[model samples]
Target: MSNDTFTSWENLVKKQLKTDDINAVLRKENLEGIDVKPFYTDVQQPLVNLPKIEESTHLVAKYHESLEEDVFAFLLNENVENLEQKTIFVNNVDLAGHISPKEEVQYFSLIDVFDEKNATVNDQLVKELLAKQFKRNICIDIALHQNSGASISQQLGIALAKAKELTEIYGTEILEKLIFKLAVGGNYFFEMAKIRAFKILFNQLSKEFNLNLTPYIFAETSLRNKSVSDSENNLIRSTLELAAAMIGGADAVYSNNYQIGNSTDNSEEISFKQQIVLAYESIINVFEDASNGSYYVEDITKQIAEKSWTYFVETEENGGYLELLKQGNIQKDIFDHAIEEQKWVEEGKIKLIGVNLYPKLEVKKSVEELYNNTEIKPVRWAEMFE
Candidate 1:
């Protein structure tokens, strides 16, 4: 619509609503330090695309090697010009047994050093990695912070802090292969903004380090959105989460099995196939930066970056992430956030589908039978209400 027509229409709406100023009436504030306007016009100021790269580079990256053989072979079948698409994420502890110079494979991988729920790289693994470079490229993952309810800004700041720590302890050489594995929560555009904000933060840090490096992001679906009782609904949640990751410029996407901390062959097959369908059948790869030029998305991305930068500076002033971790401030802060979130679920503020709404009568009736009577480990978000 023309600017003049938009102005006229806005005037009519303002009169109907009995408000003289539309911006004041319709705007709302968000956690990301931005205002949510009721409407949008053409760009008021110049804004750049998040990664500044073409869409082809952002095409869905790779698959989980843990999938059943026949299922994961889809990775081998999708031919491409380069060897990078063949890459997959692997645990650092498992690298020694799984790969060696003897194998004729080129895999781009994020060598997981620390996962808060499980383990970190031990002294021996660190020693082995320092001894010599392996065949596959490696990147360290800091996905645990997000899972624990840290804000997007905290995640970005902590990542840089951890990278610096690892660089000092391991070696700056590892940065050459560094990749960031991020867990995308169900925030849609905010999650998209998280990634773009990350790229911007890393780019600024790289300049400080005199390295012109960009991170290859591996996106994992969040554990927050998965529902145990309505297990079948996870595929739907995962599909949308995967789309957000790809459209946000994830080099690769990984979907978790619907059952939390439990992935059987069946779940693996389903998750892998779903990703294939999204990329190929659904054509998520057809566009480059699909969210680019979107007014709301672009604005949100900018706000996330700005807020995250402030967090980064505060983290540095507070003596980096390790110190904050030792003081238990980081964990406590996230825990407080989780407690607040739990209250929301309890109060019915959040719509968690089968967990809180639209549950089948049979499932509700069989809760005692189908559900585990024992304590659930690493509690689900909806556990308080359920």
Candidate 2:
């Protein structure tokens, strides 16, 4: 709606409440410290001119070592037609040998490194992969930051900084082969906006280098909020995350096998079906820009982009992403945020369905266990109470 209608509605609400300060009554703060208003008006000008997503998001399946038959059987049972359209996460190059070279499917590697030695090794490997003309081979994975409990702005900032560091070493040619692997957490709208915001910021950053680049984003469900004791709730959480990724315009997405806490049989099938339901049944793949022109989404996307760009600039001033990793600052920031969030869960401020409320009978672990390691660690928020 227009600003005039919004202003009229605001006046009526204020008169009913008998308070001039309408913002204080309706605004809420999120984890990123951004104020979310109860209602937002249509913006005259959008923050970013979002590009059209040319294809439906690819559903990525993780390939387990020595389970090639099982993976193929699941895919075949699902009647997955075009193998070339799907992506597979393979740790070793040889693991991808089952598919013909003509299939032209993409491969994602876990190659997550935080230190110099591993970074160098990964860099060399990426260069080798690119030399072989592997499509979308180099991964700029920042999913760990989210899974480890970073704010949205922090994750995007670090991602951009990492991309900058890589582009400098590999040259602008690497941009064509770059694929970002991000973790989508339970904060539905913010997680959605995070993807949109990254595209805006990354495009702007690319322009600064006299190049026009649009990023290829691959989103996966996070393990942070999943509860082992209440594993059923994980399916609900992952569904929301997957929906957010589809709406947020991720080029590809993956849902973790939530059956880890239950029966291992048919776990891959279950996760694969979850994605299938969303893509076919719900038809979320039909839209090119599902969140385009949404008042709340547009506003939050701008806020996230602005804050993330500030963080990126600050990181550059402090000698970039690797320097902070060397100084342990990156890990410290994420850990602090994680501790605060976990405390909220424990204090019953943040209600995780089966975690803090209606919890299963279980022994509690010491909170100190989380503090023992200061490095970037992956943790489930419900683990402390489970």
Q: Which residue runs does candidate 1 get wrong by more than 4 Å?
A: 1-3, 11-33, 50-85, 101-104, 108-111, 115-124, 130-138, 261-264, 286-288, 359-379
TM-score of 1: 0.79
lDDT of 2 by residue, 32-126 (tens): 88868787756657765565344877666554444444333111212223445445554444433233434465544444423532233355566
Residue-pair clashes per prediction, in order, are: 3, 0
Best by lDDT: 2
- How much is 29 displaced in model 1, in angstroms? 5.9
lDDT of 2: 0.74
Candidate 2 clashes: the total is: 0
Cα RMSD to native, each candidate?
6.1, 4.3
